[model samples]
Target: MTSNDTPEPTRPVTLWAGFIIMCVGMFMAILDIQVVATSLPTIQAAIGVAPDQMSWVQTAYLIAEVIAIPLTGFLTRAMTMRWLFVVAISVFSLASLGCALSNDFTSLIFWRVIQGFSGGTLIPGVFSAVFLLFPQNRQGIATTIAGVLAVLAPTVGPIVGGWITQTYSWHWLFLINLAPGIVCAVLAVWLLPRDRADPGAVRRLDFVSLILMALALATLEIALKEAPQRGWASPLVIGLAALSLVSGLAFVRRSLTAVHPVVELKTLMNRSFAIGCVLSFVLGIGLFGSVYLMPVFLAFVRGHGPLAIGTIMLVTGLAQLATAPVAVVMERRMDARLMTAMGFGLFALGLGLSAFQTSATDFEEMLWPQILRGVAIMLCLLPPTRLALGNLPPSQVPDASGLFNLMRNLGGAIGLALIDTVIYGRAPVLGREIVARLQAGDVETAQALGIPASVFASRIGQPADAGTAALLTPLVEKLALVQAINEAWAMIALLTLVALCSVPFARAQSIASPQLQAKAGH
Candidate 1:
């Protein structure tokens, strides 16, 4: 048996205890990322920060995650895996407290950067821990449980934040992190194994690559964030985008040739890892893209409050949490390809349903889509995670896990920016098109087809009164705008389905049977 495949000594605590601790860590991290999203307006008002500065709250965390994630291999190996978890939890918990007490945006952003350093390690560390804690046969179940908890944080964060913000204060969003973060810290220390650093291990510490990656990702993130507000072709935006691409390419070249790469090039060369990276990127597009678009769409079109939107999303988050066990069972019964495809199909369907939304649609209409998403996410996430690390050399698991999650978070940041630019760019044009058609008696055309004049007029308005029609035009025009958003959702759905096509290229790996373990001299 591989060192990784051996079971741990039976202790008073069960494997589930590790899962619980990991979940608490994950919940705190995810909660912090999103809970602040719902409270940004309040935060800005409280601190008297400019709107542009408010974006830094999110940008700082994401930048830190991006900067820290690619370095996990070095970090994990330099310190043992267990100490990494303990340190990460302790740092994240302390930062959450600092965030709660921060009197200004600068202070909050500074602590958030600290939080990111700790939070960034948590996912890869948690995944590595699961693999270490469980035998290969049970990896699927372990990963599935981890995936469910990971998904739970983002889905529930905003909902919980909204409730907390509305009922108490926006400061509570950061305050809420403190209790869970401390719990996670305590559990991590008590339950997790301590690390033993390899003093002789190579630590490349490439100053140039680190700087390039940070600058490239930071520039790209900034460009994406600003593209919607300032046109993409604007001088500042173009300069940043160009710098991002050039620096990114330079880093890629440097990383590939470096003796001790910050990112392990060889690991990503594996077909499974390559496909997994692609899948993770696509997932970023879907996960963050929707999160960016949906709440704003609901608020603008249907006028829902953050609390109401959060409530609906809470149900979805709970559904995701509930599916963890089922996903674990399914992983054993199904092929990675089939399970991933089914998951993507459900996710696409959810996004597809969202494509047709109108302002008049009730809150209930959104719930089912979110439910479908919960299912799809659980299905897709577990299998890829299993497939990626299932066959890796035990020593390389930490690197693989780190790269895998880095793509997801980077994808989230970029994806949100891309989708936002698209909707903002297209919605106005679509609105105008509908307004023009209605003024031309697309209604008269309807009336000519035996639809009543009153019905046509009530719906699309009289073609003759151009000024009045123009004044009331947004009502009819918004349907077209809604359809444009649907188009975006449809594209995301299709992208998920397209991601499934990569599954054929993935290597098929079977779990080691318990019987096989017994036969093999266990």
Candidate 2:
């Protein structure tokens, strides 16, 4: 475990096999988020939950997942990677079955919570393997595979979920996890390298720290979820926010002073790692914001079906896959800081271009923006990962990886809240202005809206023409929503550009490559 000692090498066959299993598990975990998202309407109908309460289907999973993310470090130390993956995948598969069979909202949320906790560890576990299991020479390729799954799952989730829901029952959405989860569990048990659990690590779990950590994250998640709907000033939202702040401070103090904290708060002291965490947060904002915004635009504004929306979104994932090999090659030879800068620059460009879109924009118009975002995302992920974990000693890799991934989810939670605030707050004002202009008989506005001159004349003295008003109301609402979405896109572009400032702060060390070492020795 000492820094000076060389860790034992993993067999290539075992290493690659274990990595593939990890990828499948990680993909399922991330995929479930968006997959269930697209199917929530159907699920709500089936379970008979009120519309307002249906949001909990997604919220419960996210809150549980966020709480479980930082616990990976402690769990890995206690259970070891091999047994942990087996147990986690098993629990996830069984929970998936439970979710599929649940008849009511309460049971579904209970199973979803279990599913989230089990799947949460799989994400950080895969990243930890990048530094823990692979030799320096193969780390780039290993990371490429893991990165693709991490980003790709969320990209294609709607497509897969939509197809499943349209073709089969909503039950199949959860049922889909069964076979893959089982396969991943078996492969992990058979191929992963065995290590003994550290009994000392198990005994050191700070129960108070665990309680505070859970309270802090859960309260924060609830506060954000309710803020957009309940008003940020509502007593419930304010109370939760205050509770989260208090619990968060308590958790930080306890973790820093505890003999063996559940999460190692000290990882933030590494300058490069800290910068990497910030970049990951900004990336999450753009990533989740775009994903959430697009579907809303298509479904509400364009009246597109789930299948059609999924089809359009697939363009982003295709572009990412096409760029993966090129990103891998760049990781081998390029300065990571420079690559990261270029990545965020392109991402910002993409978001900025989308900000100019009109209500008439379609898949054809979105092609280039999606392409730019797809290529930029891989660049965003790979370099920051190396910068954060590349030089850490083996003992710190797991703890650092957990914290790194947590920042991204935390960013997604906060980003989604902000995006909702913008949309809900701005749309009504825009709608009122449009209605007022039309009511005042602004000729330019009438012409722009394509209302016939005859119809405009006919309604001159009438009480706003009930039928015409009914037709125009929906159109005005759609136009207002489109503008609101454009504003959200602009905000994301600004965030992505802001991420560029942190690139230079990353450590300049190249990832270790055996060939480079050999050449230097010669």
Candidate 3:
């Protein structure tokens, strides 16, 4: 084992406190993405960005963020976790401040890239802390704490953003990170364990590997971003995808033979860990995709504003909160594989329920599906976490954790792209079908669009005039959108089921209980 296995130990309470603070820091970073997402239109208008260019704000952040995640393991070694958290949080806070102060889109996006790169470290850092700070018995409790906040941010972000946007200005969406970030950074410095930063390790860094990895992830993120809008066959998207693939392969080859590779590629040889990563990737697809899918359907099909969409989505968040304690308890008592199966099964079922949604399906129809997904959140996370990181030696946990988290993000990018393709590609064809049916005086189609029978009664035997067609066009579009979104829901549901099938392939990993470790120490 490497020197990383034997960490600087502290009192139990202090260690838990430090970990909690790190979790909070991670929550802030994650919440920032979703919060800003819901208010992007408002921010775009305020910053004087043209509509077409606004997607860059989010794209810039995602590209920089993905490039930084795997590098966290190296940074933690170069500068110990305590100092790294301090430095990253400080930069993130300063960037947030800069974003708030920026009057133009260019300045805002510049700060966003910096913010994302720094914020990316916060996630894997906390997961690494789970193994580094706590013993195996307590790791479940720790994972639950971090996992809840990780998923909770996206669930609640829209509402928070909507409330802030509606009550105050869009600037507060970013400025909200300031106070908590400063306080977290200061506390992390004092409470977290520290080790000496290595000066010469910086010299050992392989800059070529670093550049290749960054290019690969950056180009992949951009390619995924563009593929849905410009078809995957688009020459620009193809070139970007090819570049990402080539760089990724070269980086892998270089990493395997390097004197001191940036990331530990050999970690995947562990069967449980590799399968656990697949589970994480599938979870990312469902987690981020569902969160993304709901807002789109609610906003576009139902015409709900950001606040209302957030409020409706709150059901999932509330259900998750209520079920967290139960998940923690079950974690200590059950077989992890069994828990993973149940979690993904329930999550898939939840996704499937929405597949039957009609255009008129509203609050009552959505409640149960959201609750099922919420309750499954912890189940989906804690078991796979144990299966993945619990088997690794402490020395490898940092790098292993980075790769694990990165898989989830990569899954989210790919899943969202697929969801968008389903929506954008199929909507027009479905729209045409609905239009043709409506022209034939199909009452069922009209009723599905929430148009009363009386409204179409007089026009049943006649062709619709231009005015009538114009009036019905928007309703037809909403109907088509609802159908397309339902298909997207089913698609993710199938993906989650595939995750469930992989669960049994993960062999059980043994972890010593805290009591056993204490006696051994004695």
Candidate 4:
């Protein structure tokens, strides 16, 4: 016998306090992902991690999160929404404590993996509540509240992380979660309904499907990370990619055949939901990729510290705040498909604008692009959300929500990998070009890189000394880096534009699915 999600009719919930706490819990979880991002160097030194091993600090959490995200519906059903959230938050908080207490790299990574697995469920969990807990008229407002925080946490993470690291020890990053976590947990138990956990559900769990999915997602994430660094053809990268593909295919087959699938793989067959997932994927690339790109350029190319980069990043977050209300209003009145197109068009334009950046590009030049992406983010989120989960029957929303949210995360992971591939792969080639241009006395090229005319003249026709070559190396590297960054910017911008191709095919979705309508007819 398979698991069915249909619930007995219950009174509509107005548990505002519990719901708010739930959103806050989700926000904290999302925020921590980025909070640690800007402070990785401080963390690396404190934990005495080697430079080569440092990326794992972030990767471990991400790989775990990616694997866990799709299991949200399964876990929610087994434990019930109320208890699952409590358990996840408790574990997440304890993991935070463990992360703060770790004295070595190995221990920190261990805690991070646990932290990510628990935290991953919070995102889709809250979104599922929007449909399950609220009526049609109110879902717009609830979703906006959740969406703003969802996008906002990541946008503001750099500033928050930078401030925390600069003001106190890096341990404060994780320690900050302890109080909030405790409070949220207590409030959850008090305010949420006492839905009994199903011991039978746990017993019937499909372990084979679970293992396949975990292996597939984990290997896929690690492969994405490795491909850019080690080259796509590297043996280790190829093996990981192959393993991921095989396991992923097998997982799909198992889910389709199994009586009690861990996740609802059939959710992808819904046309609007599928398109919405694609849009979500594209949004993730632009959203996470932009956030990722801005910091790298600032820290590496512009020689800015964490605080300064955070200041510059504030533009995106501020824009997101200002436009959120208007977006909510528009989403109610407009056709979701048109709104989606307009949002992606502006977003693509925003991304395209950054592709022309030079080594000298900074906050002012970055200002408009960030603002455009920021304003566009609300549209990207609100409409696609409605398209994806809006029409699903209440019973199916949790599982569908997990799959919808998963696409965005997977997009972020893949986008970052491609961005890195461009930067690391193209930089050296461009660096050699810059060196050749400099050797051939191309002052125009030098001037474009911010070298003054007089400075170019002074260096021309001079015998290259060790000091001169040392002085020139930095410039060549910076020029190459900015150019490669711009190329990557172009790559994602085009991908965003390409996503628009699918919007035309996405039929406008009604508030309720046909299954719900049929049930209502009775």
lDDT of 1 at 114: 95
lDDT of 4 by residue, 30-119 (tens): 999999988888988987888888889899999888887898888887888888889999999999999999999889999999999999
Model 3, span 1-522: residue lDDT tens: 134445576888888898999999999999999999998899888878999889898888888888888998888888888988999999999999999999998899899999999999999999988888887778888999999999999999999999999999988988999999999999998889766566566899999999999999999998999999999999999999999999999999999999888988888988889988999999999999999999998888778999999999999999998999999888877889999999999999999999998877788999999999999989999999989988677678888999999999999989999999999998999999998887788989888877799987777878778998788888888888889999999999999998898888899754456697444322
How far off is residue 39 in model 2, in Å?
A: 1.0
The lDDT per prediction is 0.76, 0.88, 0.89, 0.88
Judged by TM-score, which candidate is best? 3
lDDT for residue 126 in candidate 2, whole number 0-100: 91
What residue pairs are clashing in model 3? none
Q: State every prediction's TM-score relative to the real structure.
A: 0.91, 0.95, 0.96, 0.94
Question: Per-residue lDDT for 1-522 in model 1, tens only?
Answer: 122333346453655685668767866776688889988999999989998789889888887877778777767776666566768888887888898889887798899999987888887777866666666556677787678777777777767878898899877887776777667767766675544565444444677887898888889878877887798899999999999999999999998998867667678889998898888888888888777667777777667788877776676677787787898888877787778878878888888888877656666888798888887888879888877776677677877888888888877877776676667788788777765765677874343233477866776543446775564555654565566677778878888888878988998865456666234322
Residue-pair clash count for candidate 3: 0
Candidate 1 total steric clashes = 1
Error of 4 at 99 (Å): 1.0
Question: Where is model 3 more than 4 Å wrong at Cα?
Answer: 1-5, 439-443, 451-461, 510-514, 517-522
Name the regions of candidate 4 deviating beyond 4 angstroms: 1-14, 194-197, 454-465, 510-522
Residue pairs in collision within model 1 = 355-486
Writing each residue's lDDT as its tens digit, candidate 2 over 36-79 gives 99999999999899999999989999998998889987888878
